[model samples]
Target chain A: MRDASETEKAVRLYAGTVYGIALSHTGSKADADDVFQETFLAFHSSAKVFHDDEHIKAWLIRTAVNMSRRAVCGKHRRAEELDENMPGGRFEFAADEQNDIADAIRALPEKYRAVIWLHYFEDMPVKDIAKALGARESTIRSQLMRGRERLKELLGKDWFEDE
Target chain B: MNKIFEDMKTQAMPDESTVNALIESLPEKPRKRGIRFSHIAAAAAAALSMLTITAGAVSDWTFSFLGDFSSAFGEKTEAYNIVESASYSNSASDMTFELVGVSADVNIFRVMLDIYPPEGTEFTEENKPCMNDNITFDFYLLNAHKGYGASGRFDVLSDTPQKMRVMWTYSCSAGIEDREIEFVAKKMTRTKDENAVNTDGNSIITDNEGSVIKTEEIWYTRIKTGSAPQKVKYEPGGQAIDLDRLPDSDERCRIFVTSAEIGSMSVKLNGLIRGDLVWRDSTFTAVKTDGTPVGLIFSGGSTIGGEPSSGLKDGDIILLFDDIVDPADIASVTINGTELVFK
Candidate 1:
């Protein structure tokens, strides 16, 4: 099992992944910071035992996803009113595509957005996404189909076909 | 299919030094994060340290563990060292809880408590008389690292009984462990609400208008009880979960987790809901606030709720009691000797 130092290192290593997930879901630096802090805090508070490093990281992602979902739904985390003092991490998406992707993802609703994040950003297989998200494989497959369909609808079918 | 999505994940990683800097910024010793009674451990340490500091006592700093965690890309989720916290009393007069110190490796920390009243009482915020006549259990965090803090306070009756407990999660380079501590508050309150108990041994008294009167007043008291410091195992690679356990929709839904061992765990969800929330594999689905389908995401990190789907709108209702989610799904509950049946 990873020790405290190792845990810190691991957390540090995954900071980008965590932030990426946060930014995609929240679309704001402030919300991402809260999600980052909250995800680590949840990891700090949880007591489940893990047999290996994979288990620990899974827990962290799970905690971050859960925290992100809460942030999205919570009134206190509105992106328009983020705290000025929040930790700053440069988001380097191309200016034009950034807004397009953000608006499209935001418009897809939370469920679809969650699936798309796991599939695109996290790059999990449909099966893995189902497990990580606490869903059935068949259901996840369906959601993936619909989420891609929605994205195409928002960004145009050519967007997906082109990429 | 989105190359931008793939590219961002690879490019967004923070450098190792940045992570170390963030970790280094943590108080070496345990310090309060904010001034909420919910922050009992760090606040207690802060209160105690202040006493030593004010009395010119040598710095007898103490560090309590909280928890540790890590995550990976595209993996199943996990919780390393979750625990049930105990209750404690915060009777400090002046409290400060926050980060104090940090070393290259160790995050040394401490919390101080200088008790003056029982938990759940508010003292004179201004120079006026201490109204409410209740015991005040104030907890705080004192950061020696930078000089920032937070606090949690409780105002209880002057004569109410009080206790303090601690549940901590310890993290090492390897894994985590759980520790528990319980301490009785130095000051105890014997004050009882005279209106709460009737001479006839009943907790309620009725008037003649066929209206119900609540004779007993429940005090909004906060106790300082949490687990001891324990460490969690960290992993760079992520884990996996079952897809069948995910909520089917995204709308306001109620989750019910039943256990023959611990009775049940439930939560009314307004946002995203997961199915693989508990230790045992169980049912996970999402419905609207009115118990209809909105969306569902499986344990695999996939989702299924949205507009014309199973998502929720504003003004939806969500409620949770004793981990029992979806109050409507529960047929009945017993609180303070009163049986409540949900329609």
Candidate 2:
């Protein structure tokens, strides 16, 4: 891990961003905390040779993403078992409806929303996203199309119409 | 949808407390694992530091150029005017290193800290630590008794400020120059059988107190000023010993590989294979062949005092010990096609 001062600096630089990534993925405060801590620890342990801010930020994001995904999958498995035997229990969303957007994004297959986030939120073009996600630009374009289409369906016509 | 996305943009930020809490919840600091800088420097600089050190007391000392001289393709070597005293620590560990009286080249990629020990000591005949990009400490020990000698390599070095506290109890009576003791060292690298159940009478691997000798490998390189230095390669014909066959127990096995011509040596264990091998402390230990833990006895050296023994976990495989390694070797450590081989 990094020294306390450097770790503190990293926390200041991207903890929020890391936590945002975790919260968006896991949708649970507790799980998000675990992911945030893990991502920072991973970042601290590595990233010493990180060339600059952009590289450090990307390393954090990648770590946060991986840890959050693992947490989500683990939670999903546990929830599946819990709900497996239960009867007539009401299924509830863990986060607010606004965060359902993230849920919808998570629902898409792995590479799909990766491209979408890079394109929409990260404002990265298809070529760069393609390189980052290890996919062809054409494939990223298609995945983006499919992801947006799926998002539209998940949000329903009301969201778009209201917009 | 646009409004929903915008709302997320506002709420997506992780709270300050969460970040603070996470950072706070982490240990106050990273523990210094394996090989303290004092351990390497004190071996050579022990008497010197204790002696009356004057500014520019000794000049024009020659260091062993064991390893290769020619820089490989795409290798960038950054020369730093090695200072006599610098507070350096591994960015990831709590261990700190300070140097006394030396100058050398530093490559950020390999992070190599070539130590040139003081002149006129023992074991100085061409016994150099291999070159490694992993810069841990920059100290040198020149052997006076052996006419001309250099200090062994230390794996950790950085410009960042760091220090490690050591408590040493010296047991050797042979003075600093001629002490030839076979230090019983536990092999840092282990195989499945080493940690597995042993059924045979000749079981070398066991969890019993004295059955297995565990050890860790630290790579070092020697640098010499003026003209070309030497090159040392632990690979390309280096021997790999399997520790599991020798009967399980805590037994110390000391294997001294001559790194006299090492430019750099790449160190790898089965566990530290996937990523950078961060030392718990800068110390290596040996066990009794019968499974007894033998404390590392520091003799013919200064007593900085010891704190605790540190080491890497059993599952960590050091993938890239130096900045440079063959692609095939890198691929060898990949766990299930993943770049990092944690097992």
Candidate 3:
């Protein structure tokens, strides 16, 4: 276990990254919330040593990604109605009116969505994304290519030029 | 180029309340590397490694690293060795599960496995190998069966594009013997969708296009070991009391323990207690026979009847002790006013 201060500091520093990864994977705010808590709590409980802040960040990203998938799958299998008021209450895919690019990302398949989210939103290189997700760099590269093509199909080629 | 993606990144940022909830939910104790619940025990076991190094001490129990599960249980190693002969293959998914190595002692056991997924399987977040939640098994010791309550954990020590290594370590206060371990996985939900699944170890698998990938077989394994536990015998005298038998008391409270053990990682002190008490995560001052403070270890007990609300009756109790570096030299433990003297 890490010191309380270490955990608290990480929570402050990377809550955004962890929460974003969870939110992208699960879509439901409630599930994101659950994964967010679980990721940090998992960090608090894990005895895995961290060499530096980058290592810690990488650990958090990996944990968040895996936990988010589990959370979504469990929610689907239970089929239990969540309290609509809760963040994880619904398996929602509705994008903000102002963010059609976000909607396009959401519209992609889970495999591509994850690869795309980490690459574009996080500004991570393909090599780093491959490491974070434990995939071959070639696999990540191809997934990014496919994800971008899917995005272009969804939003058309103009959005690529706009960016 | 990713301006919109960057702008909306903060939209998912957890609020102050969510952050506070996480902070509030921080576990009170540090966890061991193997098991989730045995935090204090794991933390203490970790410290044992440091103490072993600083003093330049050496023992059969002295482990340079706890990452190797096989070295932790069954028998201590002059060196770590993994037997690859025990491989079990599930042909349907082209996944082979091999029991690479195992070790067990009187109070604990460890098993290591090498999981080889199909050649084309990608290590993506969407494509994951099975975890503890996906597998269940029964452990038999001298024909006695245990389906649950084996304090253990399955951890993925390393995962790569080619292979994944998982190690499980468990402890019992009473003791564990070399026996056959039977694992039957009912379903392999490697993927959430209908794209992949297996029933037993030998089910047929199909891709999204319904192409037959591999014929799955029963993902089961039977492991037999020859080593016996190095059990320490204890004297049979401790303070005993009964309240129900007393004419002045009507409280239906009792506790009984058939065995007690103290390992380098955790302590299990099973004893009989007489009081209107429930044993769950309660605090008790613990010390070695030498007065070395056994810091942050927790003890739990159960009653004869079912249900969480029932008072503890004359039933088995197990204590998980967190920090005892050189338990080999210790002869007993003192919890509260009661002392258990081991021979």
Candidate 4:
């Protein structure tokens, strides 16, 4: 483990970033809590060497995505078992003015949502996203293209930034 | 689209309590594998604050966990240095969390810590303590050079719960240079063992509780590792014994135990295996004259204590154990695979 102080600083600095990614993936605050805790703790306990803060941030984001997938799968299983007792829907969007965009994004698949979140929200380059998500650069480009196309259909033709 | 996603930034930010909880829970040990940070989602706070620590005699009960670890890995691990100074008890709960055993070879480090649950806590059913739901403790090199790939566990807890003492043993890949290390084992949750058949031959695990435990989900214990203070000491003895024709040797492969250095608390098997072996992933069992086990067998590459060993095509394998015993008492040592009685 690197110095505990450094880990603490990472948590202080990147908790929001990790938390936001988890929220984007799982769309639940409780699930976000678990995923966020897991990502930072994994970062803390991991012996994986990092080149810089950006590398650590990428690792945290990837780990968060992985853990969020697990949480989402588990939530699905529990929901299946509990059946109607569980709330079922797209991403549990907050009551905000951005609900239109949230609703539109929620209509996309998890893959598109992930690429869209990282590409548009986090502004991570396609190469960095590939490294973080363990996907090929070409694959990320395709997914970003498809995610943008899907979003354009939901929002409108003018929704494109460079259209 | 960028403007829309940017507006979602404020919505994605984690609350202050979440961040605060992360900070409060940390400065904790560096347990790597995500067994659910008990401190993060831990229900009750540290229970040791109410309990006062008092001097209690270090009983033979402490060493019971050595048998537990032996049973867990299904190996015969010898023990020598019983770090008695590592033993401590709290008078408040009548609970004792003590470091009872330590077995270390060149690259493997195994430790057993015993916990005597307080009265009224449901720690046992028909006298067999259940497996820990999750056990996490982090040990790091304090004064020495940095090491890598050291995995920790709260694995294999005590099967014998007389006086309601439960033990957990965690083994990590620690090199010889990491002789002096600090253990930061904190939170562990104990629940009924559904799969734990009688590890010790006598007890048949017919605990109907697992069929249904309505009272509590699991007992979460906070071992006062930092608050309780004592220096645990281990001295490796110079006794060396060699064995002939190691087990699981094929025509293409040969495994050798060059020297079995039996120490006060551990026997470090310094040996190398030449060529590929028939079976290298079995267990090392040191059955005593009484037909019980007391040794730990760990597998490693050719690197012993991180130094590259030449002349070995395959790598090195280590047979480790606690409980000091004469070579005569060891009925046999099974290494790699199969059995061989050392004379």
Q: What TM-score is obtained for chain B in each of the predicted models?
A: 0.19, 0.19, 0.26, 0.23
Per model, how many backbone clashes are there?
Answer: 147, 110, 22, 20
Candidate 2 lDDT, A1-163, residue by residue in tens: 5676777788888766676666655556666677778777766654257667766676676556556655654554342433422442212233567556677776665435455665665556777655343334786788778877877888774332222
Give the runs in model 3 whose Cα sits over 4 Å from its true position.
Answer: A80-100, A157-163, B31-343
lDDT of 3 by residue, B257-276 (tens): 21133332222333222111
Model 2 per-residue lDDT at A97: 79
TM-score of each: 0.37, 0.35, 0.40, 0.38
lDDT of 1 at A42: 48
Candidate 2 C-alpha lDDT tens digits along B229-320: 22222232122323332222121211111122221112233322111222322233322335443332221111000110101122211111
* TM-score winner between candidates 1 and 2: 1
Fraction of native Cα contacts reproduced by each candidate? 0.24, 0.20, 0.35, 0.28
Cα lDDT of model 1 by residue, B1-343, tens digit: 5776666566545445655555655433334443122111110011111010011112221111111111111111111111122233332432212223221123232222223322344434331112121112222221111111222222222222222222121112211111121121222111233233222221121222322223223222112222211111111111122223222223223332312121122232322231112212333333334544422121211111110001211111111122223323444322222222222
After TM-score superposition, the amount by which residue B229's alpha carbon in candidate 4 deviates from its true location, in angstroms, is: 46
Distance from true location, Cα of A133 in model 4, Å: 2.3
Against the true structure, whose DockQ is highest? 3
RMSD of 2: 22.5
lDDT, candidate 4, B115-193, per-residue tens: 4454465444444333322222222211101111221222223344344434343332221211111122221122354
- Give me the runs in candidate 4 sitting further than 4 Å from their true place: A79-97, A154-163, B32-343
Q: What TM-score does chain A reach in every model?
A: 0.79, 0.71, 0.83, 0.81
Leading candidate by TM-score = 3
Error of 4 at B249 (Å): 14
As a whole number from 0 to 100, the lDDT of residue B212 in candidate 2 is 32
